[model samples]
Target: MRVRKLTFAALAVAAGLSLTACNGDDGTAQSDGSSSSSSSTSGGGSGSGGSEQGGGKDDSAGKSSAGSGSDAQAKAAKCRTDDLDITAKDSTIDGDDEGTVAVEFKNGGGRDCLLSGYAGVDLKTSEGDLSAERSGQESSPMVLKDGESVFFGVTYPLNESGGSGVKVSSLVITPPNETKSFSVEWPGAATLPVTDGSGSSVKVGPMGSAGQGGAS
Candidate 1:
């Protein structure tokens, strides 16, 4: 009977040890799962933060590109005659320089401007009153952007008559309806053409686009 009691006590002790072992293993598994879950959550948060930061940088770069485009457009904005450079050359070398002249208009300012329609042309003589003639084709204003130029043609005759078919020295030019005149250096040894059997000789054509034949 005593032996039986001893055996029973030993068995009870063994059952308690088995239960403790099982509980300890369960706790260890739970702890490991919790640690793994925490680590995964932290990594996900870091990835999300990195993605947001990268998005912000891309947005900043886009805005910078847009700003540069706007600045370029602003610099290409309107023009005036006072901010222009004017030049002239003889047309039709096959004939007397008295026939036609090619006039070039260039933008000499920091901004762009519009130039269209006919320009007022006149001849200044060393021996007589200035000859003024209003001439040009009626048209719309062409957009003359900064650093751009347009061309036109003018016709005049050479008169070496002993009377008043005056000799030209300088040219007086004006923009349409602006009344502002630009004096151009005349390098021709020709005389102004006689228009009405008199001493006025000047006719201007409308300005043409760049790369045009100067008369269009």
Candidate 2:
């Protein structure tokens, strides 16, 4: 009887130990699984955050690139013709006995531009009937291009040149596509003496009267 009782106690203790070991193993396995799940979730969150930041950066860069491209296009579309300028070599010339003055036009823009058709200069006077005159030569509509210059003379016959000042009034430049007019002025003739000579006697006032009428 005592042997049987001892055997029963040993069996009970063995069963209890086995149950304890199984409980410990179950706890350890559950902890390991929970740690692995937390690590995976954290890694996934970080990766997602990185992707979102990268995407935002890409969008910003794309917008900047698009803006730069638009600016470049606008610049390219702008016409490069503002550098064209024109001036009169001699803004004023002495009028003939008929009160006719000739002016020589020059190009000062130093850049290329188009000059088609003829340009006219109007002499505005209060004393007499002054008109705008154009040189009759029909020039090939030209692209003045850069650094190219041409001269045309207009004759304004003044009725009386004592107290009246003449203005260039307007200058017309005809291009292939359109016509442009610029305002210009001529020197006033305060004291002009009457002379009787052919084309060789006409000269600009404020200076001597010995040169030719159409001396370029």
Candidate 3:
């Protein structure tokens, strides 16, 4: 019994010394552990926020680069007559009360080209060449790639008088200020009347955007 009591007393003294030793140390160790954990959390949050910000910046830069590329492409030289393939087709707007033919032009060259203002057109048949005047239309520069096409419209009042007027069978097309001209076949069998006691016969306009045909 005495030996058992001595053993219990020894155990109790050892436990007390352990608790005292823990209490004797400064609180720096505990604070440091908590600080380490806080630092880890703060670092994780900062890193995530930084990643999101960086991603946004990258997206903005990408769009800016795309815009710059488009601006560069928008700057191009005027179209050359030899590098274009022109076609004429029968079309009309505001009903069939008017006679209209659409001029579809494609850039067949290796480089981009620009076109503005009116297209110089002249209707040709066995009789003579009847030049078409401008229709006071305005347009901006249009850019086209190889094999890509743009179109314009040639509109005039339908003359049914059967009077003495120039009969048009074919069209001679020339790009603005270009010497070389392209020959476009007449789209319809109906003859184009140059003038039959009318004030004006035909008018030309600039080529519009790819999907929309414009005339003045």
Q: What is candidate 2's lDDT per residue for 144-202, written digit by digit as tens?
A: 43454444444334426464433334333321233354445544343233334232222
lDDT of 3 by residue, 71-127 (tens): 655467888998888888877655577777788888998898878777888878555
RMSD of each: 6.9, 12.0, 10.2
- What are the models' TM-scores? 0.52, 0.37, 0.57
Considering lDDT, where higher is better, how would the candidates rank from best to worst? 3, 1, 2
Clashing pairs in 3: none
Off by over 4 Å in 3: 1-75, 162-165, 194-200, 209-216
The alpha-carbon lDDT assigned to residue 125 of candidate 2 equals 35
Each candidate's lDDT (Cα)?
A: 0.70, 0.46, 0.75
Name the candidate that leads on lDDT: 3
lDDT of 1: 0.70
Instruction: Tell me the tens digit of each residue's lDDT in model 1 across 114-200.
Output: 665677777777565465454645667677877877887776666555566556777777875567888887755466544465644
Between candidates 1 and 2, the TM-score winner: 1
Which residue pairs come into collision in candidate 2?
94-204, 95-100, 99-157, 99-158, 100-156, 100-157, 100-158, 111-146, 112-145, 112-146
